[model samples]
Target: MISVPVSLVVVVPMCASLLIAVLGLTKYRCHWHISIVATFVSFIASLALLYNTLQIGRISYWLGGWEPPWGIEYVIDYYSGFVLVAITLVSLLTTVYAATYVKREVGESRDLSFAILNMLMVTGLHGIIVTGDLFNLYIFLEITSIAAYSLIGAGKKKGALVASFNYLILGTIGAIFVLIGVAYLYMITGTLNMADLRAILPVHYDSKVVFAAFAFITVGLAIKFALFPLHTWLLSAHSLAPAVVCSVLAASILKVTAYALIRVMFTVFEAGFTLEVIPATEILLVMSIIAIIVGGILTAAQTNLKRMLACSSLGQMGYIVLGVAIADQMAMTGSILHLLNHSLMKGGLFLIAGAIIHKVRIYDIADMKGVGRKMPLTMAAFTIIGLSMVGVPLTVGFVSKWHIAVGALKAGMWYIIPVIVASSLLTAFYFGRVIRNAYFASEGSDQGSSSKAHDHAHNQHGDRNSESRSEAPPGMVIPILIFAGLCIILGTAAFIPVSIAEKAAIMLLEGT
Candidate 1:
């Protein structure tokens, strides 16, 4: 097994951010190059860490060579290690895709800032994954949130400024709640280390202070992850941000936030506290069901393609939360698997959306007639990914959904099965709209003709013939295709992620 510092994954990108900032002052225009290399290094380190964690049970690193409870700690078990891999892999691809897409959307003047903010955001996310100190986690969370706000606010889109402002207000409230929860826990336990908190909190599980802390933390994270009623800010932020930003936000940022919630519920506090002492599981179950239904209905109501995908993410978040509420090993495994699968699926979808917009300047679904012929390869990838989103069999989405369904049955919540079915139908209803419009809609129907579509394309790239292809640059298209391919490859080779997720679920349930 390889021996590497757990902090390596966080540090590399951080250093690169600093380097980019310095270079930006001197007119160096290779910020994307540095961002890609930093993310690649982080991805490699994450893989090594995952391999080591699987071979050895758990890994921990201490900052400043001090022991835990007295100094900061970074811990990686099955769960964090798996999450590290997912975040870094997607972040790496997003960086690659952004190299070309950012130029088209945000222009060259802001590329330096984009690269710097992107790296900083990545640094914060990696910090969140590895940190074992509650206060440190909160710190990392703020770093991530602030960087995200800047990235979104810097977008050239019409509503980008408004979207960023909404996200900032909501995101700050969530961060404050999390900070308060951390302070409350520290006041009681006198330790910021998560391991120590787990060891100490059980005796005070029935205390009102402990209950309040749990409530505060969970609600804050719910907002951060855009769960149901707290999700008002997600659609605008996701839909209006730059495509690369959308890809990272949908794929990595939200998943890690959900991971934090799971860690707090299952690791810091015992299962009994979450499931019985506080009725947390039951509450989550109700919220998740509502989110799944409402999110789907809203998704189908959207006219813009990016808005539709953003709405669908709300429903997808519901699936992950459902698995958590089930609180069974299989359910947890499904939740974790879906985290990885959804990252690949939604990330690719957003990239495709960006590609379409970049190539043809079409964002509204009604304007997408004959897009399939105009961008056949891109649309093909979209079709596969869209199908995966609908939980079609032999795709990664179906595997995770199947596990969640079985988990529901195993937990004797047979009613949840129908919720899953209903969500799937809703998913098909929405995604199928795009699929049909892209591939089967008559080119000369009332929507628009192939020639007219070319006229629309003319605005972007200047006078393309009806028969010409309008794929995004190779840098962007390659990553989108890679994400789509992984959806199928990982679906068929389900054992890879399942084995890791199964182990993580077991450890989480057993409180190891």
Candidate 2:
């Protein structure tokens, strides 16, 4: 089979950011155009990488004509390939969603900066997915984090700066933990290549140094993943950011952090080490449960629509980690597939929320009453994603949960199945509140819900229509509708993601 160069996935977006700096910054209208084109190209490259990986199995490309153990390599295996496609595809769609949004949220003058940060953020994500070196992963992780910090703060909201700073502090500490872990591993094994470390780290697994490294890495990732107690920064950061920023962070960033953990647990160290030999998997399992329960409860309690969805994201992330903690074949497949499913699901939901904010300027669920009537198409997209999050059948969410349930049973952890079902109900409960508010609750009596709950836009500008039937701009609406369609399409025919996830799981298991 012919080889496909994987670096283009990163190059396309990176170059676009550079181009935007040179030409698009001065011209605000050009930012969205550059972003869309650049992200689309990266998406195409990711597709190529996925196709080539499936045909040839694992493909490791050495950088600068240097071989492994001496140079950084980009490994395109089933796991990385699957993640690459999902990240780039969502990144691309986000640009489509952002086309009209950036104009309103960031304004015309700063459009280029927003576009550059956005592109760089995605470039960092792709780098994390493809890099085979441990230290390289940390660098990419920082790149993504820094870009995210800037993007979150760029919004004109009152606390946007505070939220961004809180995230920067927490995220910087997490990055430090990860860096320390990388250094510890290198000290003993004298290698940074994941494959090389995996080959060399066995005897050291029982040593205190090795265990400390594991602890540091796991703690860092847990913070990044925002698993329950560690999620202090997630809700505000996601809820306060601009629409485009919120969608990308909610739909993509956390998932990639989990993917990085998957790499460390399954690729660099050994699957057996995580699950059987150490307490890591067990701790992950408990944390995953707490994340689900707490996130769901908080989501139900939230009065603000964005905070509710942001909290809900914490719970959904629990499902991904839960599947991996199960570490069984079917469960692992479900876990990996959930990453993709949730990205599409949450991406659609957040974009619709963005649209709601864009057109109606309301964030409270109660204020959304009759708002759906104003934005039928956007609300319809929101409904589809909401039901999916509730694990309704014939949706991608159901497919993922189904596999995980069966995987739980097959692993003799049958009791957890009820917990999964219950979590779905909790999801439905909160989303149901929104649906009722949007469709049934009377909006006339409500007085803007709460002053602190929303961004409170003034004089409602270009994105809104004065006449009857105002909806989000066409650019934003199109991406939401496409993702909504995908929720059904992927759920009904989940064979594609399931098959790829299964292959990735198999490869990881075999390595163990």
Candidate 3:
């Protein structure tokens, strides 16, 4: 099979950010155009990579003409390939959504800066997915985090600045912890290539230094993954930021951290060391349960729509982690599957919420009473995703829950069964509240059912006058429809895609 170069994937977006940054100095509008074209092209390229990876088993490309163990390499496995595709597609949709969401949330003058930050953010995500070196992972993780901090602050609110700073302080400490872990691994293993490190590390698993590296890596990633008690920074940072920022952060960054953590736990460390020798699975399992319960209860108390969704995401992510902690074949598949499902589900919902805020200026859930009437398309789209979140049949969310349930039974972790059920109900309660307030509640006493009868009477009389009604702008409507359609399409083909995930799981299991 012919080789596909991976540097192009990373370089394209980074170059675009540079061009946008340069154009930003000239005309802000020019920067937006440049950034959009760049990401769109990158998205298309990612699609090509996905197709190629599916056709070919795997793709490995080394940087600067050096071999894998000596130089940086980009390995395209099924899991990372899927991640690349999903990340770019969301970035593409959000770029389109951002044009509308950002214009309303931020000033036109800041558009270039927003575009630049977005390109760099995605570039880092791509790097994280492809890099075969541990140090490269750290570098890309920093890139993604720094860009995220700036993007959060780009909204220019005092809250935005403060939230960004809080994240910066906490995120920097996390990055340092991760670096310390990498250093410890290198001190003993003497190689930074992940594959090489994995092959050599198992022989010394009982060493105190190797165990310390494992501890440091786990704690550091917990900070990034927002694993329960470590998640204080994410809620506010995600809640107060602009819609586009929230969508990207919710959909990708945290998920990627989990992905990296899984990669390290299952691949870099031997199963004999991680699962059998140490109790990583048990610790992850307990913390995941806590994250699910706490996040769900907190979401029920939120009055702001975006903040509620942000909190709800914490819960959903916890479910993904639960699947990973369960450690059965089906459960691992479910966790990976949810990584895809959650990104699209939350991205679509957040965009719609942002649209609601953009058009109606309504943030409180109470104000959305009868607002659905004015925005049928947006509300209807919201209903589809909300039901999916509740694990309704024929949605992606149901597929994930099904797999997780089966995995739980297979492992005979009967105690976790109730926690899973309760968490599902909590999701239902909060999302059901949104639907109840939206479709069931009356608008107001003045705009009551009787006034609706009068309007119906006026309409029946063939009066030439009536209030105007229209859907959201095409930019917003189109992406919502695309994502909603994908929810169904992916759910329908869930088993087929899961084959790839199974292969990935098997590869990690067998340690080759």
- Per-residue CA lDDT of model 1 for 180-210, tens digit only, reads 9988998899998999999999988878889
Candidate 2 lDDT at 465 equals 42
- Residue 426 C-alpha lDDT in model 2: 91
* Poorest 10 consecutive residues by lDDT, candidate 1: 457-466
Off by over 4 Å in 2: 1-3, 24-29, 445-467
Q: Whole-model Cα lDDT per candidate?
A: 0.91, 0.86, 0.81
Better of 2 and 3 by lDDT: 2
Question: Best candidate per TM-score, number?
Answer: 1
- The residue pairs in collision within model 1 are none
Report, for all candidates in order, the number of backbone clashes.
0, 0, 0
Q: Across residues 112-181, which tens digit of lDDT does each residue of candidate 2 receive?
A: 7888899899989889999999999999999999999999998778798999999999999999999999
Off by over 4 Å in 3: 1-3, 445-470
Q: Which run of 10 residues does model 3 get worst, by summed lDDT? A: 459-468
TM, every model: 0.96, 0.94, 0.93
- Give the per-residue lDDT digits (tens) of candidate 3, residues 276-379: 88888899898899999999999988888988998998888888889988988888888888888898999898888878887778787866665556677888
Q: 458 in model 3: Cα distance from truth in Å?
A: 18
